[model samples]
Target: MTHSDTDTLRAIQHTERERFIASHPRSMALARDAQQHYLFGVPLHWMRDWPSPATLFVAQAQGATLTCADGVGYADFCLGDTGAMFGHSPPALAHAIGEQAARGLTCMLPATNAAVVGGLLSKTFGLPMWQMALSASDANRFVLRWARAITARPQLLVFDGCYHGAVDDTLVDMDPLTGGTLPRASVLGQVHNHAAFTRVVPFNDLPALETALKQGDVACLLAEPALTNFGLVPPDTGFWEQARALCREHGALFVCDETHTVSTALGGYARAHRLDPDFMVVGKAVAGGLPCAVYGFTHDMAERMVQAKNAAPEGHSGIGTTLAGNALTLAVLQASLEHLHTAANYAKMLDLASVLEQGLRDRIAASGRPWTVTRLGARMELQFMSHTPRNAQDVRDHAQSELEAFTHLFMLNRGVLLTPFHSMMLVSPATTLNDVAQLLAVFDELLAALRALPARPATAPASRSA
Candidate 1:
């Protein structure tokens, strides 16, 4: 990419943004009306982050498509950013939630379905004990408490560019220049320094990980099977094997956060790869897009946690919320585990994802663009670089924000929705080959527009001053 090419892309994005506002009068009006009551004119502040001129108000969503307030249907590859990864409003989940709604929503007491769900979870995830929370953020937070309690250590080890929900400790990133941990600058309203107890290491770097653990201070190593937040960066071959060994050798608990990587398999990537971890978490889709997150533990880990709990003076464990593990959530989880997360459904999702991956690669090749595509089961991401990124710096160095904005807006105008934060696309079991083909066709148009830009002498990107 050149300066001229970037200017041309920005111009195209401006035109697309205008086209969106002109076409979506209903959504624009709704947004204007909502501004009086809602922050940033939307229920969630992040909704305003989309490249569209205004937030799109979804009238309805089902399967792999959603209708906006303007009555335009879009092939919804975003899938609520993997919260609806299985599919929107799955029939079994809908029925279960409806029935549970009449019975009662949330009671402090356990429901009958809780036992059944426990059995299914143990069978699927290879963990003997489980706990619940309202979101992956809560689950990760609660588990970190348990980790510190059991290991009696003060620090946590996390990879650079990793995202484990909004947990405060995991928000720290490695400062590239000084190689020191720093709280991510994007996080809002932080008053305390998080780097004191959080050790940051780059993904796939075994030596750095070993050196960090050798300090004998980390209580746990919290990680995802693959990096999906900044972009999809898969683990190198045999990476987890050595990483797990190092954690165990250093007496630190190993935890895998599968909130996004749950799309990889019925039991998530940890079970699929036989990577033994003391704790594992699955959220978002676990309760059919409802607010529920489950963290599981191995038998030994469970025993250690029990001992920690027994030793504490009884007040509050600082673990659960009032709405955690409600009857409605358990009912939905039972239905989803039984029907939605089945092997057959996953096969369909994986097949569709393969089609999507190949289609994007073909389009990139045809356009003569130095772009690449990476897939993890049902999830895939398109990076504006020639190869998969190896670490966080690789991701930053290769990112083309202007190009991403233009591509996202282009797809939005053509009744397709990619994830707002990145060029990530997810394929559900309900996604058809025709839908994939349609997305590829629009992608071809985007490429053609990029190729039409006049060539110019390329200038090197300026070096960072700080």
Candidate 2:
């Protein structure tokens, strides 16, 4: 972008910020009160990442809508960043939570419904053995430990710009200049070097993945079926097929982290596409917004896990937490599996998402903007570049920080909430055609507003950490 483009973006952002502040007096007041006790005026640091000047305090959230403390309602495309992918507080999950709460919460012992839930998980995910965790971060960490223990290997491999939650091993980035792993610069208080045991490679790069796996030291290749953190970069055609083969050929486990890509299909992208990973992790919306995650593995992998455990000294195996697999979470998980994770819900989500994807593509073309929309089942991303990115490097090369921030704030000001980290949107089963139409109308307004600005020739975007 040129100086004129930058000035115009900043000017629009200023107006949007002013509008937001004026309309959110209640939120502003709450934020002021919260700053006295809560760090960054929020419960979690990430809650402060939104472009709004003050944290938007929620009054209520249900279905696909969120109402802020200022009585402003929004079409919630963010959906708690996939934690509410099945829509906020589905009745089945809510009732299950209430019923389970009255019975028991956690007892550090298996719930009576544990065996039934296990059967549901195995039948749904096509994996015979399973484990539970409070979050996908914990699940990924435990999977890594198991993979390393069973294989007796020291290194793990992951794709560039992949996010498997807050797992330390998956946090390293692939250095573009050196083609080696480097500790992510933005991570705080990192004493240990994650790159020492984690090999990083670009997504959709078969040769790089093969070469890395051929090293024989890698225990597992942890990956999302499609890259979601940096942007929606889907794997190239036949990428997973060949990638899984290479892992098997090199004697490494292929672990698919479907936390985000769970939106891809009812059973997730791996099962829908027949990737058949050695292990799989699904979280976020798994229990209809409850704090639960489950990882599954093949029977062979289960046997290896047992053998590894039996061979080790019997103390703590460094896996799981006390709160995992609690009775409440299990009840909700069962309810979600029975009701939310169904063909009917997915059909509605996918149909509406197709309409949304086409609407975005049509608007972008009519506006003649150099933007592209990529879709995976019910999720879509409107990238600034003309082509869909294949890797994190591509995402970095086309990064438009100012434009992205402006888009998010502009939409938020218009009663639409997008994912704060990127130009991503998710279609939930609760989303309606009117909601999608409202979003498109606002998006059209955004396009027109940008079109009114001074035009400039595009330039290479400055590299920035995500």
Give stretches of model 1 more than 4 Å off. 453-466
TM-score, predicted candidate 2 vs. hidden true structure: 0.98
Q: State model 1's lDDT.
A: 0.89
In candidate 2, stretches whose alpha carbon ends up further than 4 angstroms from where it belongs are: 454-466
TM-score of each: 0.97, 0.98
Every model's Cα RMSD, please?
2.4, 1.2
Output the worst ten-in-a-row residue range by lDDT, candidate 1: 457-466
List of clashing residue pairs for candidate 2: none
Model 1 over residues 301-380: C-alpha lDDT tens digits? 88899999999998999899999999999999899888888899999999989988998998887777788999999999
Backbone Cα, N, C clashes tallied per candidate: 0, 0
Q: What is the lDDT of residue 88 in candidate 2?
A: 91
